[model samples]
Structure formats: C-alpha cells, structure tokens
Target chain A: MTFFGLFLLFFKIGVFTFGGGYAMIPLFFDELVTGRGLLTQPEFANLLSLAQMTPGPVGMNAATYAGFRQLGVWGAVAGTLGVMAPSLTLVLLVGIFMNRFQTNTYVRAVLDGIRPGTIGLVAAAVIFFAESSILRAPLQSLWTGEGKFGISLFGAAAFCFTFMVSKYLKWNILWIFLVTGSVGAALGYWGLI
Target chain B: MKQFQRLWPLCWEFGKISAVTVGGGVAMIPLIEEAFVDKRKFLSEEEMLDVVAVTQSVPGIIAVNMAVLTGYRAAGIAGAFAAAAGAAVPPFAAIVLVAAFFAGLGGNRAVDGMFLGVRSAVTALIFLAAIKLYRQTIKTKFSFLVAVTAFVLLGIFRVDAVSVILGAGVVGVVWMLLCRRKQKESGGGQ
Candidate 1:
C-alpha cells in the first residue's frame, strides 16, 4: 500500500477504536491481516506482544512497529500522524463546545451502544491472539478435521499461569512478560517446546 | 512568543510521562495527574478530571488525547501539537530501534522462543482486559445483547468489526427511543 493508504488505514482504525489499545486489535487484524494481507497472523501477534512490552500506548506502539516493518521511518511517521489526527481534531472541537457535547442525548446514546460493542471486540481479540500465540494450529482445524489438533503445552500452561497472576495478583505486566520470555527461551534451548 | 514558551515544557512533560509508563494509555493516568495537577500546578484537580473524562470519551489513543487537551489548556493549539509530538516520539523511536534490531536477528531460535512466550502472555493480558471491560460495560439486558451479537458477528461469522460497532450504535438509539415512546404511551393511558 502507498504511504497515504497506510495513513488512511490507521486513521480509520483510530476512529473506530473507542475503549483503548486492546479495542484496536480486532480492527487491526481485520484491516491489515485479512483485508490487505500486509501481515501474517504470527507477525501481527508478535508485534502486539512487543507493543505491550514497550513503554507507551499499545495502539501507538503497534502502529509504529507495523508501519516501520511495512515501509520505513517515514511509514512510521505516517502511521503515528494518522492515528493522532482524530484525537487532535475531536478534542479541539470538544474543548470549544464542552458543555453541550457532554450533555447531548445523542452522544450518550451512541456511546451506550459503542461501549458494550467494544467489549465484544476485545473478546474477539483474545481469540485472535490465542490462535496465533498459544495454539500450534488454528482452532478451525478441529472443526474441519484438516490438520492434527496440536498445541504447545508449555504455552498453554504459561497462558493460564499468566492469566491467574494478572487477574488476581495484579502482578506488574512487564515483569510477567520478562519472566515468561526467559522461561520460553530456556525451554527452547532444551528443545522442550 | 508566550505560546511558544509553553510548548517546550508541555512537550517535555508529556514526553517524560510517555517514556516511562507501560501497559497502555490508561496506565499513564496517575502519572499524568501527578505531573499536571499536583506537581506543576498547570491544571486544577477539577480540570484534570474533566480532561480524563474527555479523553476517555473521544475516539483515539487516550495518551495522545490527554496530551493534546492538557497542552491546549496550558498554551494553545501549538502547545497541543507540541505535547502530542512529545507523547508520540519516544515510542516511535523506541519501537523503530527494537524493530530494526529484531529484523536483523531473524532465524535465531532463542529470539523466536522469547517471542513465543511473550505472545502467549500477551494473549492472557488481552483476555484479562476483556473480562475487566465486561464487568464495566455489561449492565443491562440490552447491553448484553449488543455485546453477544457483536462477538458472534466478528468472532464466529468473520464479519468486519467496524460495521458491527456502528450497527450496535444504531440499535442502541432505536432501543432507547422505543423505550421512551412506551413510557409516553403509558402516561397518556393513565
């Protein structure tokens, strides 16, 4: 895609993303993976993990990394600007007409619908990440009975462990990533995974 | 000149915050509050809350939105640009550097394994985020319906997510209006 097209794609992603970074994932998968075929599922999942590890907004980090991979530094610039444009424009407008916009019934109604929808989108993102991350093959293989139903037991264990710690213990996210990554590396060195 | 003077400080403050915070935009909230409201005295407490509300309400990355709004309050439009640039540049530089490093390291088993683990952990994080959002967003039956419908369309049917989001909004408006109409009719009958 042209640089402008890249910008426009992210601009649309930015506009549709209501809740936050994770909310952008499903849209990112749809537009870049399925629609344009710019990134494979594994590549997308890898980028997301890197985005999470990095310091900044996950959406911005993902956009920058994806754009850089696709083009270069200029592509990164295009993606960043595209994602920020909507916020700059809309914030300015809201700043000017603050009270009315806050009180507007239509605005409230739209958000009411959009908020719940965002939950579903994030839920879908979980499956998208899981397909590419933990599962050795696509879950669809089970339904079609095409390839063997394979998985990385270590990866599944890591996922469950990570989920419990993050959900209940509230462990620092960066630490969790570092520890898991090191374990994976060591295990791989031993041919365990 | 006065606006320009505020630009660097605005940029520097936001850049500092973006450079350190992890997880995502929401994670940066307390630090932002600390920098602007408590330390620098740039905005009052009430104003900070307003900024948070507005940033969360609008569609975009929340970190950039917070920077723009707070920077505008500090200086002007130019300050907004300055803050946004500050907020954006660190991650851009960091990711570009990391991407370049990894690009050259292809076919390395160790790096591959590291990512494999990292990706699994990332999936778990996304799942946690979804659970938290479900608690926050799913309150009423209508909302539950919208959430379920959106999930089935996107997850199962492979329908595009953008259309599902927009469709949900239309459904919300119609449902709300119909409820209001029913209330009015009952009042008239009484």
Candidate 2:
C-alpha cells in the first residue's frame, strides 16, 4: 500500500479504537493479518509481543512495525502520523467542549455501552493470541511437521507466574518483562524450551 | 512567553514518563499522576482522577489523551502539543531502533524462542487488562451480559469488533433511558 493508504488505514483504526490498544487487536487481526495479508499469523504474533515489549502504545507500535515491515522508514513515519491524527483532532475537540458534554446523557450512554463491549474486544484479543501465539494456527498443520506443539509448558508457566504477580504484588510491569524475558532468553539459549 | 516556560517543564516531565513506560497506555498513569499532582502541584489529585476518567473515556490511547488534557490544563493549547510531542517522540525513536534490531534478528533461533515466552507473558498482560477494565466498568447485570455477548461474538463467532462496539453503544443508551423512565414512573406512583 501507498504511504497515504497506510496513514488512512491507521487513522481509521485510531478513530474507531475504544477502550485502549488491547481492544483494537481484533481490528488489526482482520485488517492487516487476515484481509491485507501484510503479515503471516506468526509475524503478527511477533508484532504483538514486540508492541508490548517496546515502549509506546501497542497501537502505535503495531502501526510502526507493520509500516516498517511493508515499506521501510517512511512507512513507519506515515503509520505513526496516521495513528496519531485522530487522537490529536479528537482530544482537542474534547478539551474544547469538555464542560458542555461532561454531563450530556447521550454521550455518556454511548460510552457506557462501549465500556462493556471493550471488555469483549479484549477477550477476543486473547483468543486471537491463543490461535497464533499458542495454537500456532491452521490446525491441520498440527498433525504435520509444519506446526510443532504451539503451547509450550514454559510459556504457560510464565503466563501464570506473571498473572499472579500482577494481581497480588502490583509490581511495575517493566520488572515483569525484564525478569521473564531474561529467564526466557536463558532457557532458549540452553535449548531448554 | 509565560506559557513557554511552563510548556518546557510540562513536556520534559511527560517525556520522562513516556520514555520509561512500557506495556502500553494505562501503565504510564501512575507516573503521570506522580509528576503532575505530586511533584509539580500543577493539578490536584481529584483533577488528576478527572483527567484519567476523561482520557479513558475518549477514543484514543489513554496516554496521549492524558498528555493532551494535562498539558492543556497546565499551559493551554501550546502546552498540549508540547506535552504530546514529549510523550510521543521518545517512544517513537526507541521503537524505531527496536524495529531495526528485530528486522535484523528475524531468523535467530534464540530470539524466536524468547519471543515465544514474551508472547505468552503478553497474553497474560492482556488478560489482566481485561479483568481490570471489567472490574471498573461492569457494574450492572446488563453490563455484564453485554461484556459476555461481545466476547462471544468477537471471539467465537468472529464478528467484526466495530459492529459489536456500536451495537453495544446502542444497547447502553436504550438500557439507560429505559431504566431512567422506570425510576421516574415508580417515583410518580409513590
């Protein structure tokens, strides 16, 4: 796609995105992974992890990574700008009309509806990740040499560990990434899964 | 001129927060609160909460929205752009470098395995985010139902998310209006 197309695509995603970056994952799956075929399922999984790994909003990180993968540095620039545009415009509008609409029933009602739906969108994202990152997609490949067992025991351990720590300790998320990523790297280096 | 003085510091504060923050928008909030409310005394704790609520409600990355609102509160529109740029640029540059490294490392076996672990952790984080939002937003029976239906539709049925969100918006408005009407009628009867 052209740079303008990249920008427009992200702008659309930005405008439509509700709740947060995680909630936008399904749209990304549909538009980029499934529809445009910009990246394979595995690559998309890598993008999600990378987006989480790196600093920035997952939405922006995904846009930048996708753009770079597609068309180099300029693509990244276009993608970032595209994603930011809607927020720039809308935040300004919200700031301008903050008092007028703060108590408006219609706006509040729409958001109330959206709040619950966002939960669903995020849960859907979890399933999407399960398919690509855990299940390794295209289930038929499971019986063939193409798809090794997608769910690793170590990965599950890490998930459970992080979930518990996050729930109870409320540690800064960066520490979780640092510790888990280090352990993961050490395991991989040793070829220990 | 006075605005420029406040603008630079506001930019610098958020820039620092953005630089260190990871795992996406919501994670930066506490740091934002620490800087704006505690260190700078630019806003009260209550105002910070309002900013968080508004930013969360808006259709953007909450980090960016928070920057825009906080910046505006501190130093008007110019400060808003300054803070947004400060918040955005550091991560942009950092991710660009990371993208380069990842592109170069695509075939490395160790990297692949490491990412496998990272992806799992990321999945866990996503689940945590969902639970956090669910607790904060899902207060009523209907809200819970909408959450479940949306999850089923999107996850199982593979329905488009945009449609689900909009449909939920309609559901929310109608449900709210009906509840209000019933309350009004009950009060009139009394």
Candidate 3:
C-alpha cells in the first residue's frame, strides 16, 4: 500500500481501538502481518520487543518502525501522524465538552462500562503476546497442531519469574527487564534453550 | 512570556518522561504521577486519577492521551501539541536508531536470544498491567462478569476487541439505567 493508504489504515485503527496500545495488537497483527504481508511473525515479534524497550507508546513506536521499514522517513512521519490524528481530534472535543457532561449519568455509565472492557482487551493482548513470546510456531500450530500447543519451558519460566518479581518484590521494572534479559542471553549462549 | 515559560517546561517534563519510560503507558503511570503531581504540583492526585479515567475512555496511547489532556489543561491547543510532540520525539528517534542497528545485525544469535527473554518478560508486563487495571474496574459482580466474559471472548474466542468494548459499554449503560430506575420506583412508591 502507498503511504497515504498506510495513513488511512492507521487512522482507522487509532479511532476504533480502545484499551490503549496493547488492545490494538490484534488488529495491528492482522493488518500488518496477515492483510498487508508487510512483516513476518518473527520480524513483528522483534519490532514489538524493541518497541517496548524504547520510549513512547507501543502503538506509535510500532507505526514508526513499521513505516520506516516499509517506506523510510516519510513513512515514519505519515504512520505516526495517522495513528495520532484520531486521539488528537477526540481529546480536543473531550476537553471542550467534558466539564459540562462530566457528571452526566450516561457519560459516566459508558466510561464505567468501558473500564472493565479495557481489562478484557488487555487480557486478549496477553494471549496475543503469548503467540509470539511464550509459544513456538504459534500460527502454524494453530493450523497444523504442531509446535504451538506446548509452552516453551524457558519462556514460561521467564514469564513466571518476571510476574513474581513484579507482583511480590516490587522492584523497578526496568531493572527486572534488564536482569532477566541478560540471564536469558547467557542461557541462550550456553545452549540452554 | 509567562505562558511560554510554563508550557515549555511542562513540555520538557513530559519529554523527559517519554525518554525514560519503557514498556509503554502502563509502566509510565507512576512516573507521570510523580512528575505531574508530586514534583511539579501541576495536578492533584485526584485530578490525576480523573485524567486516567478520561484517557482510558478515549482511543490512542494512554501516555500521549495523558500528555494532551494534561497539557491542554496547563495551556491550550499549543500546549497540547507541545506536550504531545515532546512526548513523541524521543521514541520516534530511538525506534529509528534501534531499527537501524538491528538491521545491520542480521539476526545476531546472542541478540535474538536476549530478545526471546525480553519478549517473555514483556508478556509478564502486560499481564501485570491487566492485574493492576482489574483492581480499578472490577467492582461489582456484573462488572466482574463483564470483564471475564470479555476476556473469554477476545482472548480465547478471538472476537474483535472493538466489538467487545462497544458491546460492554452498551451493556453497562443499560444495566446502570435499569438499576437506577428500580431504585427510584422502590423509594418513590414507599
């Protein structure tokens, strides 16, 4: 697709998705991987992990990285702007009108309702990430019932270890990522899998 | 001059935040609260919570949404753009550089190994985010049910997230209206 087409596509994605950037993963994977054939699963996985490691929002980072890969600097700009346009437009309207309707019952109700729904979407994202992170050959296993069914023991261990540290220890997450990532690399270097 | 002084610093503050914060908006909330509420005193804690609510309700990245909302409150449209741009600039530059570096690596073995670990941890981060949000949103049994059902539908069944979100909104509005009506009827009749 052309850069303008990419912009419109991201614009639609930005407007329709709720529950923040993670919630958009399913759609993003579908559009970029399945629909457009822009990125392979492994490349997308790398992009996702890198997107998290760097700053800014995942959605924006993904757009920038993917766009750059697709077209270069202009693709990056268009992709970023397209993803941002919907929020920019909506926040302005909400800013102007929210005070007046701040206490309105229906407004409150919708917001209230949307909150939990966001959780569910994030939960979906967890599974989405698992497809790349925890499982091996996720899409292939879905079709052929091959390598995807079982969790990679190492990945599961990493996930469980991270969860425990995050929930129980309350260490700074940045340090957690750094330490766990290093350990993983060492293990890999040693052929530990 | 005063406005410029105020807006520029606020923009820079968010820029600092964008540069440091990793793992997306979920990880950034505490940093945002610390900067905007504790250090800067630009927003009270309650106001910050409200910002969370409004930002969550809208579409887009929560970090950017927070920046826009908080910036607009601080200044106006220019402030909004400034904050948004400030927050965006660091990541834009960083991702490009990282991608360029990775492009040269040609799937280096050690690097890919490290990323494999990073991906699992990132999944854990996402799971943690859901747990944190669950505390806020899952108040009553109905909401609990809604959340669980939404999870099942989207996560397991692979239903469209947008459809589930919109559906839950409709259900919540109708549920609340019904409860309110029943309360009024019971009290008024008595």
Candidate 4:
C-alpha cells in the first residue's frame, strides 16, 4: 500500500502541477504533512534541509525519500522510476517525429509572443514576494521591528555580499553556498537568523 | 522525408535542454518553447504553452509533463515512451551515477568543479532563455494591457491561473460565435 501510495502521490503531483517543481511545494507540504501522516511538521523542515543538501530538484528528492522510507532500497527504486515514468514515455514519442511548420511565420509569431507573458509571469511572482517582504521594511520599523521570517535581513545582506564576493573575488559559487549554508546552520543553532 | 533523420534533432535538443534546464528544471520553460515550438516547430506556441499550463495545473515535473505530452502528440504511446525514455535516461543516468559513485564518492575535486561550472552555465542558460522568450511574447502579443492584467490578477488577487486560462477560453468561444453570426448576416445580405 505504501509503495503504491508513494507512486500515486508522485503521479498525482507530476500529472497536475504545471508551472514547475517550485509550484509543487505547496502540494508537497499538504500531502506529506497533512495528508499522508508520513512526516511531521518538524520533519518537513528536516526534509527540506536534506533536500537543500542534495543536487536534484526538491520534488524529485521528496519522491525519492518517500520511496526510501516506505520500502527501503527497492522502494526507492520504485519511487524514482514511478516518478519519472511519465516524462520518459512522453519525450521519446515527441522526439522521434518532425514537423514542417518548423519554418512557418504565424507559428513563429505566436512562439515569439509567449515570451513576454512568461517574463510577466516571473515578474509577477517577484512582485508578490516583494510586496510581502520588501514593502514591510517601514512597517517593521513601527511594530515588531523584525521582518516576517526575520531571515529577511540575512537574506538581503547575504545576497548582496554573495553578489559582491562572486563579482570581485571571482569566488566559486559552490564554496559560497557551502560557506553560507554552514553559517546559516550555525546561526540557526544559535537561535539567530 | 526520412524518419531517422528527424529523430536526430529531437535527441540532440532534448539532451541539450536536459543539460541546460539546471537548478529548477522548470527554468527550461522558455528554452523548451524555443527548442520545440520555435526552432523545431514540432509544436505550435499555443499548444506548447497550453500543455505547460495544463501540466502545471495537474501534477508532476513540468519537464516530465512536457515530455509525455510531446511524445503522445508526436507518435502515439510508443513515441511517448521513446521520448520519455530518452529524456529520463540522460538525467537519470547522469544524476544517479553522480549520486551513487562519483558525486560524493571518495575524494573528488575535478568533478565538483565541473558541476560548479555547469551550474553557472545553467544559470546563464535560464536567464538567456528568459530574455529570448520575453522578446517573443511581448512582441507578438502587443497587448501590454492583457499581459499586465494577467500579472495583476495572478499576483495581487492571487486568482488561479486555471481560471484566467478558462476565462480566455470563454473569450475565444464567444469571439468565434460572434464571428459566425457576422458571417451569416454578410452572406444573407450578399
């Protein structure tokens, strides 16, 4: 049941959520934390921590973890395969064929048109986050004096510092990430953002 | 005319997109559009974008959804299987092998450096693709109004993208109806 459950959860998520893996985070939280009872609230944090430490996307990592948790190694195998089964099947079929409109004008025009909309979509997301985060600077001045997550300072400062470091020092990005993660972890342990 | 020749470009592009889609893989959106919709013309822009929206509203990775949709549309189930197989094979073999043996295996500096470089490249690829797609979309729509409205509705009201898409569907249907009615009048008068 657990094995099939894992596959179904992933399939459901995979088949539905479209924009991308990031968009699936809400569902991941809902299904894992609320639906399955597979993981606890605190455990979700730990799972995120583990996810951050890995290379692949978060959705795939969660599915992989679910498999490993339920049926062990074989479970992991099933989980991974089940998660990827749709994509593997789909691309192959499309890839084998060719379309002559490969050079049509109107089709090219439409293809060209979608780009701005895509940018607008991304920009809207940025605006949504910024309204909640950046605009609160003045409000935080009057109230709690701390941003919602309280990590905003760290986020802003670290972002700037990292940019500077990368630009001038020509520093390695992985090293920056490792160093930042270690600092963040230590700060977390010390009860500071 | 020959089938095998056509397959070559798909294999190469999928492989390339797989490699470039880095970090989020979702970042491959604009690139995928360019590759399959614009460059290859394997699908129309509207079809690809619709697939993207539908795939998102459903479940799974966007890349996987795309792979499946493209496969099904192109060559029945088997083509889907083949494209999917090809798509997954590269990333799976790459990620897993890296995970199993090389990623954290023993003392490894060179491989880590290579990944770091690739990460930088993927970031570059995403930004580049985003810019290219932005050019395509903005120039074609020429409707800053609709675009802005979409952003506001989606960002501020936090309406479901699906609803907006549906509303567009309604507009399309109504427009078709109106056009038909006009055509009937024109024919009668003639």
- Restricting to chain A, the TM-score for each candidate equals 0.94, 0.83, 0.84, 0.55
- Top candidate when judged by lDDT against the true structure: 1
Q: Positional deviation of A189 in candidate 1, in angstroms?
A: 2.5
Ranking by TM-score: 1, 2, 3, 4
* Deviating ranges (above 4 Å) for candidate 3: A17-19, A137-148, A187-192, B26-53, B184-189
Task: Sort candidate 1 into its docking category.
Answer: medium
Task: Indicate which candidate wins on TM-score.
Answer: 1
Model 1, A48-129: lDDT tens digits are 8888888889999999988888888888888888888888888777876777988888888888888899898998998888
Q: Ten-residue segment with the worst summed lDDT in candidate 3 chain A?
A: A139-148
DockQ of 3: 0.61
DockQ of each: 0.78, 0.61, 0.61, 0.15
Please say which candidate is ahead in lDDT: 1 or 3.
1
Per-candidate Cα lDDT values, in order, are 0.86, 0.82, 0.79, 0.49
lDDT of 4 by residue, A71-163 (tens): 665555666677776555433333333243334444333333332333444444343323222233423334555644332554444445555
Error (Å) of candidate 2 at residue A52 is: 1.8
Per-residue lDDT tens digits for candidate 2, residues A95-176, read: 7788776789999999889888999999888877766545655444555557555666777888888888888998777678
| Candidate 1 positional error at B105, Å | 2.4
